[model samples]
Target: MLKLGVNIDHVATLRQARYRGREQGEPDPVRAARICEEAGAHGITCHLREDRRHIVDRDVFALRRTVRTRLNLEMANTPEIVAIALQVKPDIVCIVPERREEVTTEGGLDVVAQEPALTETRRRMNDAGIEVSLFIAPDPPQIEAAARVGAQFVELHTGRFAEAFGDPAQREEELNRLVEGARLAHRLGLRVNAGHGLNYENVRWLHRVPHLVELNIGHSIISRAVFTGLARAVRDMLDAMAGYTGGMPGAA
Candidate 1:
């Protein structure tokens, strides 16, 4: 079964719009995590971004205490966040690239470029007995670099493929790249996961991807929650993804 790591950063984003710094109110991310778990979400993912634009320190601590399912902390490979991760010790730490300006994570981290630093970071987290995963592009070089850096898993960045959605030729090409990337990563013995811009519709086609164990989705699910409520939103997504485990029905 494909695990759904529900991202609640946007829930905090909605809260931050009016709650001021650290104030509690309506769209509480902590409560959201609890709701998600009760609804059968495999995990709760939240990025404690550098800018504090969305998820913040308090939220991470709350989640660490409240999240019954796995608490995956999406962070950047920076000293502050790294220290926080070590002290808090979430179940999984996914290192993603960040820019203060971008509305969301624009793309994956360049593991090859940051190998030395990333390796050290991974070592620290591993020493703490915390599993580490790198959010990276679906490229062989990046995957190999991640493995070399001692990452237990590599989360394939699906932004390019998601952006290509609805365009037959481009979508096929990008999907092929993801398929090949997953094959190479799996061959290297790294567990595989993917996310970014995935939703109810685009996720179905991912039944073709091999060796994928988890998908971290946010914006789409959160947006859908506005209409259907949180529990149904998660169950609905799991229902949508249930058909994917056996591999694509007829894809070559």
Candidate 2:
């Protein structure tokens, strides 16, 4: 079955927006993550950015202690985060490209350019018994680089594919790239996990992708919670994903 790793970074984002370092009357991301897990999230993902913006250090530690399901910690290849990850030792560590200026992760890590950094990072995480994943664009070179760096998984950046949702021509092109990228990665013995800009409307389309082990979605699911509530929103997405397993009829 295709697993759903719900990203809870944005829940902390909303909390931080109100608290703004004051730390009062804020919804705890750990609690929200537990809710998502109870509602059927296979795992929880939180990115601890360089700037203590959304998911702070405390949130990561709390989630580590509380989340029963797999914990996928997204971080950059930096000394500070590396040390923290070694100490916390989450189930998985997904290395991604980060920029303080960007509102969110704009795209995947450029593994080709940062090959040495990725290689060393993967070694450190693997030594700590942590599964290492590279959040990379659906490019052959990047996928190849991930394999060379001994990454356990490759999370395809689906932002561009999501953006081209309504355009048949553009969507087809982007989807083809992802499909091929997944195939290539699988052949290289790397587990495939994808996410970025995936929402209810476009998520089912990902069913066409083969060998995809997981999808780490956040902003869309959190936004939907504003109306449907967290548990219900997570369940709805799980139902959608369940429909696609075993190629069940009428999944879309």
Candidate 3:
């Protein structure tokens, strides 16, 4: 069965909008995580960006103590963040690309291009007993590089597939990339996961990607939580992803 990793990064995003100077709050990411866990989410995800933008150090630290399920920390490979990750020791570490100018992660990490830097960073995280994953576009070179760098998993970026939303031809083309990428990575023995732009609508079709073990979704679920409540929103997603293993990752 595929697992659902609910990302609570945007909960902190809302909180940060008000408390730019310090930690003051109404919407708490930790609390949001608790609700997601109670609702049967297999894991909790948070991306502690370099700019201190969205999820902060305080939140990750608190989540370390509070999250009952697995804590998958998405981060960039930098000395400061890697240091914090080692100290925090989250269950899983997914290295993603980051740019200060972009509103959100614009694309996946070019693991093929940055293999040297990622090689060392992956070593540090793995040495700390944390399973490492690389967030890369579903391209062969990047996926191949991830294994060479010693990452245990690779999160296939689905942004392009998602952007093709209503266009059938574009969606099918992007889906082919993901299917082929996941198949190749799986053959290499890399545990595969996918994220970025996965939600109620598009997520159902993701079951089509072979060998996807987990889906780390954030914005869409959080946005739906505004109307349906977090628990129900999670359940709805769970319901949407019912039978994802038979040539499709999720059920109707």
Backbone clashes in model 2, listed as residue pairs:
none
Instruction: Give the lowest summed-lDDT range of ten residues in model 2.
Output: 243-252
RMSD of each: 1.4, 1.7, 1.4
Measured by C-alpha RMSD in angstroms, how accurate is candidate 2?
Answer: 1.7
Q: Ten residues in a row with the worst lDDT in model 3?
A: 243-252
lDDT tens per residue, model 3, 76-172: 8888999999999999999988989998888999988899999998888888899999999999998899889989999999999999978999999
- The window of 10 residues in a row where model 1 has the poorest summed lDDT is 243-252
Name model 2 segments beyond 4 Å from true.
245-252
For model 2 the local lDDT of residue 236 reads 88
- Over 1-252, each residue of candidate 1 has an lDDT whose tens digit, in order, gives 788999999999999898857567669999999889999999999999988988888889989998888999999999999999998999999999999889999988999899999999999999998999999999889999998998999999999999999899999999999999999888899999999999999998888999899999999999999999999999998887886663555632
Local accuracy of candidate 2 as per-residue lDDT tens digits, 26-142 = 688989999999999999999999998999988888899999999999999999999999999999999989999999999889999999988998998999899999999989999
Give the Å shift of residue 16 in candidate 2: 0.8
lDDT of each: 0.91, 0.91, 0.91
Q: For every model in order, what is the number of clashing pairs?
A: 0, 0, 6
